[model samples]
Target: MFLTYKDLSELFPNSRGIRDINLPFHTISSFAEQNQPKGLFIPLSEESGELGKAIENGAIGAIWEEGKEIPKYTPNHFPIFITNDIVKGFKEMTKQYMKKIKTSETKNMDMTKFLFLEEKLLNENFKTYDIAVVEENLSLYIEQLSEERRG
Candidate 1:
């Protein structure tokens, strides 16, 4: 869940163009106020001083643009991800996470189908084929999402 600022930039190519963009992670002030201990914080600069301040303020890590010289003040203990564009990386990561979650849901559906089939067989009922039709519909929905993601 720790995304560097550089990765976030790649995911949001127009970030520089926009004056404000809502970050996926909550703001540090909000996190502090809520006493939330776990979340990612992406700083906008590779400057060591700025990054160090963010880390000191409870940032778990950072994502910085590749080729930009990291400031010497950055602590070695803080994690960093260097990327060509942060926004794109963030978007790609989001897509992958969504796909994994969908796949897990599909697996759960498969288990349910097995259970239904078993029950039908035990009752000597031949209507279990209906489960296949339902599964086909589910598959179609998943396929549509996949196609949209690809586009």
Candidate 2:
């Protein structure tokens, strides 16, 4: 999936705003060698100055520990997402991405099935609801409802 730094900031607004590069990254990798051309590099325990290596290898950005010092030699303009807990942040991002995937896959599915899924989702007990999580599903339902009204 393609995501710019702006999109990331929108999804996780706490993140520092970096460039608006339209990098399409699919997965996050720890090792620079394994990083996909547009993927996000997460430097978990790199030696003091290794962030540049990851960026040089084609990572669009790096996610580093919140308090860890950023390498000075690394270009200041490169995007960096800092988190107190990298694993948690990564999992949250993955969950958001997966929802997008599921929604995209079901966009053309039958309305009845989508309705059932929406109902099931509503039945789940959460302390608070996030509308964005179910937005795509609801959009399909709304479209179908509108079409039924017109017909």
Candidate 3:
């Protein structure tokens, strides 16, 4: 149930892509190096170097700010979503992902028993002890399956 570029397209209609819109991305990662299974890069700066780093590190695609110069290294067929407000667009995409999860999987789950979140969308740096550290770390990795946690 991973989200595809097509799913995000509905959220950002001003996007530009010359490739397949159905490419699946399971995580939303900011740091390029940590993505084991490809991720969607969220451009935090208008610098092409930053975007290029993410791409070179294996970002499947990115949400590019309108008017920002894309890196020359970017392949012509790469998917580049254009948005006037990067923050708003990023928020909308994650929010919709959560909504879809709630209406689908988490709708029937008992919250007390399973504290499931779309951990893929959240890359946390933990500072906890022993089992707590492992627990937190494992939680982040668990949702990259079967469409991930429903919110």
Candidate 4:
């Protein structure tokens, strides 16, 4: 599911909002290469250099560590969400979303159930490709449902 910047702020009240860029984002990644224009980036360390580079490459925002001073970049345009416990927060939120998927609907079956079936077909390994495919399908399915509801 997608999470707007405001939703993230609500989920993480302690997180500091930088530049107040309330954009919708999905997926979280630590790798700079994996960072997307609409995804949240969590740097490996509190290094301004890395974070700056990430923003240079189109990373929309970052999840910063709590109480840590932000970098002294010339223009701090990217939004930042500070967290007391980044690992725990990310894990708990991801788990919550997975649970939400279990209850959400799909085209012909429950999203979670269909994912389980797909995993079974793939010998239950549930490789990265399997997860990616499932996520893509579910995203499209959710969007279609939203459009239909609006119509």
Which regions of candidate 2 fall more than 4 Å away from where they truly are? 45-49, 105-151
Best by lDDT: 3
Tens digits of lDDT, candidate 1, 54-81? 5555555455667767668766654455
Q: Among these predicted structures, which one has the highest TM-score? A: 3
lDDT of each: 0.39, 0.53, 0.58, 0.53
What TM-score does prediction 2 earn?
0.58
* lDDT tens digits by residue: candidate 3, 67-136: 9788787887778889987656755665565555445554333221111123442655443223344344
Across 1-151, the per-residue lDDT of candidate 4 in tens digits comes to 3555765675576654464534766544555554355657765333223766666656676777687677787255567777776655554444555655555553343222221223213343322434455565444434443454456
User: Model 1: how far is 54 from its true place, Å?
Assistant: 2.1
Using TM-score, rank the candidates from best to worst: 3, 2, 4, 1
Indicate the worst ten consecutive residues by lDDT in candidate 1: 111-120
By TM-score, the better pick of 1 and 3 is 3
Error of 1 at 130 (Å): 30
Candidate 2 accuracy as lDDT: 0.53
User: TM-scores of all models?
Assistant: 0.39, 0.58, 0.63, 0.57
